[model samples]
Target chain A: MELGQKIENGMEGRTGIRNEMQMSFDAISENEAFARLAVSAFVMPLNPTVEEISDIKTAVSEAVTNAIIHGYDEEYRQENDRETKKVQLHCRIEKDMLYIQVKDTGKGIEDIAKAMEPLFTTRPELERSGMGFAFMEAFMDRLEVVSEPGCGTVVLMEKRLRMAEEADEL
Target chain B: MENNYSENFKVIDNYLMVRMPEEVDHHKSGYISRTADDYIMKEGVGNVVFDFEDTRFMDSSGIGIIIGRYKKISYFGGKVFAINTDTRIKRTLMICGLHKVIEIME
Candidate 1:
C-alpha cells in the first residue's frame, strides 16, 4: 500500500479524503516559517476558521523548531552531512479532519514521558522555554510522539473541523 | 531624549518601544533579546513596551524573549508592557503566564 493509503487505513472513521500533500526540506531555522506557510496553504481548501488556521500554524512551527534546534546538533551539521538532516512534513485532509506528521532523522528523545512535561527541557542554557510539546498539545485535538534513541522522532497531530452546520450549533 | 536604534526599535519618553517583525520564532528571538537588553542597560529605561500590532505569529521562543526582558527590567524597578496584541498572540501570552508579569495594554 502507498503511504497515503497506509495513513488512511491506519486512521478509522475517515469518511473520504479531500486532499493530500507531502514535503521534505532541510532542517534549518529559516524553513520554520516556510513549513507553516505551506501547511496553511495546503489546508486552505477546507475553509478553516482564522482560529483553526492559527492553531495549525502554531503547532507546525513548534514541531519544525524542535526538528531544527534539538534534533540536528550543531556538530552534526558542521560535518557537512546534509542528506540525513532532513525534515519531512506530511499532511492530508479526510472528511472534516486534518492530519499532519512531522518527522526528523536526527537525535531522538530518550524519555518521551519526561520530555512531555510542561517545563522540562534538555537545553536550558539556550533559554528554551521548554513548552514546545505543551503548545502543540494545546493547539491540536490529538498529538502523538514516537521516537527511538539515536534514530529519529515523529510528531503526529490531528484536528477535527466542525462543518458549517455543526459549527452553528455551538 | 529619544534614540532610534533601528526601524523597529525606538525610545519614547521612558518607555523603550519595539515593533516586532511579522514572525518571531527561535531564529529571531535571540537577536531581539540581545538588542533590547543592550538598550535597557545603556539607556537605563525603566519601562519596555512591545508593539505587536503587526505580528502574525509567535512561538515559545517569543515567550522566552518576553520573559527574559521582564526579568531584566524588573530587576531595577522597571516593567514590561505590550500593546496592540491580537487575540491569538494574547492567548499565547496568557497561557505562558506572561500576563502575570507583563502588562498588556489596550
Candidate 2:
C-alpha cells in the first residue's frame, strides 16, 4: 500500500509512530466535535502540556471545520444518495515532532494563496473568520497545503516538541 | 457547545461587563461582535472588561471579535480589558496580537 494508504489503515504506535483515523460525516458545523476527537487522539501521546494540547485541538478543529463548512458547503448533508464528500485526517510522530494531515474529498481550493491570508474565509455568512490557516500556522511550527482544483485538499502540519527548558520558558 | 453572551452595565460608573462563553472561534465571532455593538448602542457603555475565565479555547477569529470591539470602544474614549485567561487561551490570544491592544488581568 502507498504511504497515505498505509496511514489510513490504522497505523498507530507502529514502526514509524504513525496513527491514522478515518470517519465520514454529514460535514455539518455541528459535527466539528468528531474531527476534534480524532485529532486529539493522535496528538495526546505527544506529552504536550495541557495548554499545548488545546492549541493543537483548536487548530485541527478549524481545518476539519473548514473542510466541512467551506469545501463541501453543507452539500454533504444532502448527498445521502452518493455520499461523496468526506473529510479525512492522518497524523504521524517522528523524532520529537508531530505531523498532521487533513484531507477533504470535496471542492478543492481554487486560490490557495488567497485562502491562506488572515481572516480570508469564503463563508462569511456562516461567520467564518477565514483564519483557519492563521491559527494552524500560529500553533504548529510549519504548515503546507497541497490541492488540485478537481481533486482535493491535503493540509500538512508539523510541530517540533520544545525542549523542557524551552517549554517552561515560554 | 454553543457560546453565550451577556452584558451588565454599571449605571453610575458606565462600565460594561461582557461574559463570554467557552471557545470563541469562527462560529462565535459574529454573535460576539453583534452583542458588543448592541451594548455600545443601547447602554452607551464604552469601558468594558471581558471575562474569559471559563473560556477554554480561542482561535484567530476570536481576536477579530476583540479587536472589533476595542476599535469601537476606543473611538468613544473607552478601553477594553480581558481577565482570567487559562494558559491555552492566553497563548492563542497573544499570538493573534490581542495582548498589544487590551489590558490583561489575572
Candidate 3:
C-alpha cells in the first residue's frame, strides 16, 4: 500500500494517531535512562510487543548517549564556560510508524560516513564500542544523520510498528 | 522463578558469575564494565560467566560490555561464557558477531 493511503486508512480506525512531543534537557549521563523511559512511555499506547519496545528503547539510549559523550566536547565546553549544554529529542507517531529525532548543538562530525562505520570510534581509549549508529540502524527500519563540522548533529530514526494483537479495541 | 532486577557479581567454583539486571543499556554498561574488570583482576580468575536469565532488554552496549570482558579475561588465557539468553538477545549477539568469539551455554 502507498504510504499516504496507509495513513489515511489508519486514521479511520480507532487506533490511528498523529501525536508528537519534544523535550530538551541537559546533556548528562543520568538523563540517558530518563530518555529511554520517556520514549518507552510515549509509545505505550501503541501496545508494542516486548521485543519491539526493547529495540526502541535501546536505539533511543544510543542516540542520546552519543549526543552527550561525543557531541559536546569537554574541552570546548570548558573553554566556552558553557556548563548547560542541552540535547533535544522529538518524537512523533503517525499511523503505524514512530519517528524520533535527537539533536545536539555541539561539535559536529566532520565525516558522518566514517562515523557510522561499525567499530570506528574517535575515543577508543574510553572503550567506546563505536557501534551506536550500527545498533540504531539494525533495530530501526530507517536511520539518517545530518551534521556540519561546527554547527551540530541530528539523528533521525523511524520504526514501523507491528499490528498489536489487541488493536481491534483501539 | 523469582525475578531479580539488581545487577550483581559473585564467584562460583573458581568462575566469576555476573548477574545482569533486567535492562542492559548505556546507563548500566559503565558500572558493569568497571565492577567486572575489578573482580577479574583482583581475584585472578580465568573463566567468567554472564547470567542473562533476568535480562529482558539489551542494546549494543551489552555487546560491547561482553566483548570488553572477553578481551580482559582472554588476555590471561581465560574463556568467557554466556547463559540464559532468549531468542531476541541471542539474535542480537549473532548480529554483532559475538557468538563467534564467546561461548553460549544453556
User: Highest DockQ among the candidates is held by which one?
Assistant: 1
Taking the tens digit of each residue's C-alpha lDDT, what string does model 1 give over B1-106?
1133266888888899989878889878777888888889898888999999889999888888887888778988898998999988899988888888889875
Model 3 Cα lDDT, one tens digit per residue, B2-105: 12322378877769899988878766788888888888888887888998998888777788888888888888888989899988788878887888889986
Top model number, lDDT: 1
Error of 3 at B64 (Å): 1.7
Chain A TM-score compared with the true chain A, each model in order: 0.85, 0.76, 0.87
Instruction: Give the docking tier of candidate 2.
Output: acceptable
User: Global lDDT for candidate 1?
Assistant: 0.85
Error of 3 at A81 (Å): 3.9
Better of 1 and 2 by lDDT: 1
Candidate 1, position B16, lDDT? 92
Q: lDDT per prediction?
A: 0.85, 0.70, 0.84
lDDT of 3 at A130: 79
Worst 10 residues of 2 chain A by lDDT: A10-19
- RMSD per candidate (Å) reads 6.7, 7.4, 5.9
Candidate 2 vs candidate 3: which has greater TM-score?
3
In candidate 2, residue A147 scores what lDDT? Answer: 83
DockQ for candidate 2, please give it. Answer: 0.32
